[model samples]
Target chain A: MRLLREAAVIAGKDLRIEARSRVTTNQVLPFGGLVIVLFAMALDADRPTLTRVAPGLFWVTILLAASLAAARSAAVEIENGAADGLRMSSLDGASIFLGKAAAVAVQLVGLELVLGVAVVALYDVEVRSSPVMIVGALCATVGLAAAGTLFAALASGLRARETVLPLLLLPVLAPVLLGGTRAWEAGFEGTPSDGWPWVQLLALFGLVYGSLGVLAYGSLLEES
Target chain B: MLAGVDLDVVEGEIVLLSGPNGAGKTSLLRLLSGLLALTSGEANVLGHDLAVDRRSVRTQLALLGHDTFCYDDLSVVDNLRFAARAVGRSKHAAVEAADRAVERVGLARQAHLEHRRLSAGQKRRLSLGTALVRDARLLLLDEPHAGLDPEGRDVLDALVRDAASDGRTVVFSSHELDRARGLAGREVRIVAGEAHGGRFPTAAAASPTTSTSGSGSVSSAADEPVAGVSAARAGVDTEMAPGDAHEVSP
Candidate 1:
């Protein structure tokens, strides 16, 4: 219970800071929207092809935005030496991991919503499996956040963090991309049953990364 | 970047760490506060082994570094409140503590202002207030007087003295020899990653015109008087205060 409360406090602090800064809303969200528009342009308004690739395109846009959002979240702590203050505070490492991942997950969810609408409108896609699509997005966001938070911490001390974060995070998040895309494809194709297996894969991926983050964050935090 | 450094600080003792730039004073303080990992040394703080129980050690201490450790977008009071909550204070208690800390640092008027809007001195005061709000046993301050005005520096001295009077340990790094000479009970000089301890000329030693009790409450004696000498010789009476449990051990 105490750990949960601490995690809530951390999450609340991150969300409040982001709300005040409007970085995610003003900057990252627009970037995600632009990615969708670019994807449509790349397909040359080929309606059938766009519809078929909409699920992959949507998840791709989210993953791209997730990288930026995660980096920004970690940057907030690194700026002003807040990371050291966090290390000195009494909160446990697991709580910090949970809080940071949750914040990223929240931001990604918001981006996914905007991107989801874009894919449907621009790609002429229909949500035949709404439930499965929601579940797939939820599981994929958790996995992306978990892996992104870990890699963000890894790259935070580097001088090239902005550039290096994507390099480190993208490889680790390949499974999330694959599983999310496959599940969304099934959902868009009106086959919810086929999507459940990919949803499970995404869920499992989230669990593994989430657990790893909780256990490893303390050591990572202690490192110079 | 620190090596072969061994130092011990007792409860209620204000130890000033003086060193040149890159002398590892800040690194040593970070090591003690459990922010940096010890490569191959045994260390314990506040009854917790730093290598094995870092979280507990961190909880028992506060560190004020060059960075303000505040979100630029959050209000001054919000920053303190968030820090209080981070240290496991309840929400209600965090709000109360934050309010008191803001008032203590003389930032009540600027409490609602976003942190980025505050001037350098006000930001430093707010940072000090963040540390003040935590119930940590140890305070690790790095260059704490950098952006402070004369009044702010005095408030910092009083706050440090008050905290020591309440039996907490303070280890701060500073380069201002004359100003720091007055506040610290003992001055530890760090050179080439090594720490050497020596007694500063106490207020009593510098001037015999004034005598103060051992409680360390005499703010005017900051430059010339020492309070813990008697307590150190006789040993701090932890039985008188339940919160001072660390002094009983070692």
Candidate 2:
């Protein structure tokens, strides 16, 4: 209960700040849309190939979207020197990480919705099995988002933040990307064969990434 | 409302953290108050070890630092509200605390203004106000008087005294020796990475004729005075009345 309250306060404050600034949402939308369009253009705009690659393509776009969005979620707090204030507050590191991840997850969902609709319309891919795909993708996105925000916060105060975030995040987020694409592919094929294992991988990624983010966030904040 | 440090903060004690710049005084306070990690140290703040019971420690302490922590986009009152909620204070208590803190800092009229609209000095005062709103037992201030006017300083002094009188441990750091004397009940001086000795100004030392307001106190180890104050003591007693002079052995 206490953790929920802390997460709410931190996430609420951050979400409000993002809303007022519009920098986060604005950047996520256009960049994510552009990436989806590029995927469409690169795939020869064919129906079957687009359909076959749609799950993988959609997961890839979502991964990039989550990565970019999560990168700034904590970076803004550190950049403004507010991380010190947050540190000084009674909120623990897990609460802080969850709060940041929550906001980033929200942004990713919004981006995914836009990209999902566009991908289905443009590529004529069938998403009758998309509910499972969407859920699996979300799990993977949360894992990536949680881990990405931690690294972003770690790197935010450093020089060359834009270059450093992906460097630190991509290596750790490899599991999520692999599991997410696989899970989404299995779901798209509508057989549910061994998709459970990949889904479990996403869950494990979430737990490991979330726990590590929680434990290491304090040290990162202190170092910053 | 009494707050104790990992080491005791005795009553009627004025502790100083005198040191060259970047001696980790601010970081120490933050760590003790559960703001920064222990890294490697045994700190049992108010009987709560940071390693084992950080949540309890956090509930009992407040930390003030160079950064104001004010949300630049929000109104001053809203900023305080956020802090209050963070610490689990009631909304009414939070508002009351915010009002008193803002009024105490002479910024009552600016409570509704955005933080970015405030000046540097005003920003510092806002940080002080945020600490004030926590209603915590321990108050850890980093350069609390960095940008205060003389009147503002007096108000701050009174607030610190009131807090001490109520048995709250008030700890802060500063570079100005004169101002340090005026603000701290006891002072701890840190030089390089190590803590140096400290005491109040005496009539026969470096500035005998110097007034209590702004005299340069003798801080060197070579010029020790015969005052009732101690030399380089940790773990002060806060409930003791201010100005209780007593001879303390090093």
Candidate 3:
């Protein structure tokens, strides 16, 4: 109960701060949209080809936007001198991680929803099974958000945050991208999901990263 | 092993940890606070073994290091509210506590402003206020007065005194011996890895049951400084009382 309360507090503060500075969402949304637009222009006027690639394009946008959104979620905390204050509050580091991850997850989900709508409207993509694909996309994004927020905090303390973030983040997030892409591919093919294995893989990635990140955050915050 | 190095702090005792630079004062404090891993000996803080229940110990204690931990991008009030939430408070309580803390630190007027916009003195004061609001039983402050003006120092001094008075154990490390002397209820001197014995001169003012383990001596009375100590250079490891500074190799 206490942990949840603390987590809520941390999450609440994060949401409030994000509300105050909508730059996090504003930056991610346009960037994701541009990626979708660029792909549309490059893929030629082939409707069937675009439909075939639709799930791939949609999930790609989700992956990029989710990673970017989650990365900036913790970036704001460290940049503002808020991380240390959070450390001193005597709250468990895991609670802090969970809170931040949850907020980032919310942002990712919101972004994915927008991207999902945009994909269907602009790309003329056929939705074979809407519900499962949406759930899979969200689950995969949450997994990425969990992992990305942690690495973001780690990178934020480093010397070159912008340069270091993607380097540290990409290798770790490779599993997320792979799993999300594979699952979306399976979904688009209208085949029985070999995607189930990848969905399970994403869940594992989320749990491992979430737990480890929370455990490691306290010691990291101790670093100069 | 350094003789007479074992030490303990009970509630309501303002233990002023004094040592020259490199005296392992901060290291010792960190070890006690569970921020640093111990080399060998076990430490138990607030009934939780440091090795066994470090997490629980962390939940109960608050640490204020030289780093004025605050998020520069967030408003002063938001920072405090985040801290309150981390400690398991509701949003409403967090806001209330933050408001009170900002007021207490004289940052209420600037509460809505970003932390990065604040001056150095304001930042330090803000950090101190956050520590106070947590109301943790054990408070670890490293160089608590660094970067503060005289007026800010006085405000901090009062806060420290009040914490000790209210039965909160505060172990603060400082190079400012005069400031330590003014605020500390009991003075602890560390040289290298060794803890030198010093009398609780102010014990008579409150508790008279102060005692030392091993061959350490206890001083009587409040006004007198700890007798004739060698003066060690700053950052040198030495075990000596407040007035007496001794040097020892680790």
Lowest lDDT sum, 10 consecutive residues, model 1 chain B, at B226-235
Q: TM-score winner among the candidates?
A: 1
lDDT of 1 by residue, B126-227 (tens): 999989888777787888999999999999999999998997778898998789979998887765455555223443334211111121111112332211
User: Which of candidates 1 and 3 reaches a greater TM-score?
Assistant: 1
lDDT score of residue A27 within candidate 1: 96
Give a tens-digit lDDT track for model 2, residues A91-164: 77778778878888777777777887888777666655665676677788778778878878778778888888
lDDT of 3: 0.67
Docking class of 1: medium
TM-scores for all candidates? 0.85, 0.73, 0.75
User: What DockQ does each prediction reach against the true complex?
Assistant: 0.59, 0.35, 0.40
Off by over 4 Å in 3: A1-3, A44-51, A74-90, A120-129, A150-224, B1-10, B19-22, B186-250
Pitting candidate 1 against candidate 2, the one with the higher lDDT is 1
**Candidate 2: residue A168 Cα off by (Å):** 2.9
* lDDT, residue A116, candidate 2: 78
Residue B113, model 2: Cα distance from true site in angstroms: 4.6
Off by over 4 Å in 1: B1-8, B39-42, B199-250
Worst 10 residues of 2 chain B by lDDT: B208-217
